[model samples]
Target: MPPDSDGVPNKTRRDFLKKSSFLTAAAFVPVTVVNAAVNQWDEKLASVFEKTSLHLEVNGLALNLSVEPRTTLLDLLREQLNLTGTKKGCDRGQCGACTVHADGMRINSCLSLAVTNEGKKITTIEGLSKGQELHPMQEAFIKHDGFQCGYCTPGQIMSAVALIKEGHAGSEMEIREYMSGNICRCGAYPNIVNAIQEVKTGGLS
Candidate 1:
């Protein structure tokens, strides 16, 4: 022990020796053991926060991807897979601009999680066409001028295709009701309905 300025003993030397010995022992530990401990901790954390695998078919192409749990189907399509045809109008799933076909059913991709769509067949606007030939609905839209700015055309076409397939496009009123979810800011509702009606009457789908 050492005396302070007042001649009173401070901490004893045994305490200092004990701390020094502990530090020295810690310093002498093997680097391999330290690295192993760190690796074990990292692996434990990785196991808890591991990314999930999603296997699905997109636009006729089979894909096996790893995605975080929070990744939405719209983001996975537009961002990860580079499929930009599916527009991201209202990411809250209101405007229906991110519509896509999943397992033959029309789905709001913005609201569907990528993980939930595992093993499902996804079809976007790009998948509607075969090679260089345009789908009949595409041709009908072009003929009827169903869009102005074309921002919502992809979602509209996707929904129209699904509506025709599901036998919901029986009349103009039915088309309007089914397509009400897709909001075209350009106000091309009449032309869009005409295009869908023509395709439905012609049995082009």
Candidate 2:
């Protein structure tokens, strides 16, 4: 204790302690509120349940599954069925590495929701080949050395399969424009175009 004026005891420590405690509590108010809100949000999000069954024909096999609502079709294919042919390059819809045919239409599998694909047919690269026989596009790609690293080959093949079905194989420039989504970082564009043309023109063995 310190002596105050006129020999009275001063309450400097007590006053300082009281003011410090009040300031500390006031400063912690917003932090505590924010923490509480964050905890509530996490609890709410965790409480949401989404276990729904999905049925689809994947790679020529009928699959019945119970998946979470937020699961992607790409994840189901790659993570669940172990069909890693469809590479996960960007996971975003921008890159065409995860391209697959959903009911004969090319779509980014990573962007496709699993629940949305229920009862639909999905054609992956694994489904393109018959027993002991390669599809024409696969044969052509191998003949022309169309891919170097081959990560994008499956997507390219799937797209080419659909492209041929859609009758977009009229010319070289047309093929290039149609196949532009599937990128070959090894600069195998010329070979890829030749492969597509070969398959279209009966040049593939």
Candidate 3:
């Protein structure tokens, strides 16, 4: 027996070997792997709930904001920026109540994600006029009585402005086709067409 064993009492070779084998197995158990797995789990959880940064211009005002991944542009305008002129009629892409101009082109804000429109210039219905003076299209709509409930008027005016700019107002039928997406529950189609025609002719001040 070794000198170390002689000094010890009642510690048999079988018992020592078993304890040593347990210690040896524990030494190779990879504790760092367990710590790494925990860290990876934390990172994934943070990524799932983290808000993303967004940079965009609204009504010529540059803004920096943090938004959720699922936030829609319509909600960002109406709820976040308080531009409630852009109504939330359908929330889906069907109704044109959430129309807005992105980079001078009209789009259904309800269908666009806020994150996707980062760095874009967005124009809401509230951005149409200067101070207290109305936009030409707004004046035309008022003169022609294009809306009744006014719930869909903002979107309608936005679309009409874009339509005239796009040259789709060449004919009444073409204008109607292009403006079909915007629904006025008040049944003001004739007046809406007249308003658009008047604006197309450059008759408004």
Where in model 2 is the C-alpha error above 4 Å? Answer: 1-49
TM-score of each: 0.76, 0.76, 0.77
Every candidate's lDDT:
0.85, 0.81, 0.85
- When 1 and 2 are scored with TM-score, the better candidate is 1
- Residues 1-205 of candidate 3: C-alpha lDDT, one tens digit per residue: 2125557734465455444544554567667445545555434444444567899999999999888767899999988988899999998878899999999999999999999898999998889999999999999999999999899999999999999999889999999999999999999999999999998888986
After superposition on all CA atoms, what RMSD does each candidate show versus the true structure? Answer: 15.9, 17.6, 17.6
Q: What would the TM-score be for candidate 3 when compared with the true structure?
A: 0.77
Candidate 2 residue-pair clash tally: 0
lDDT of 2 at 81: 87
Estimate the TM-score for candidate 1: 0.76
**What TM-score does candidate 2 get on C-alpha atoms?**
0.76
Candidate 3 wrong stretches, greater than 4 Å: 1-49
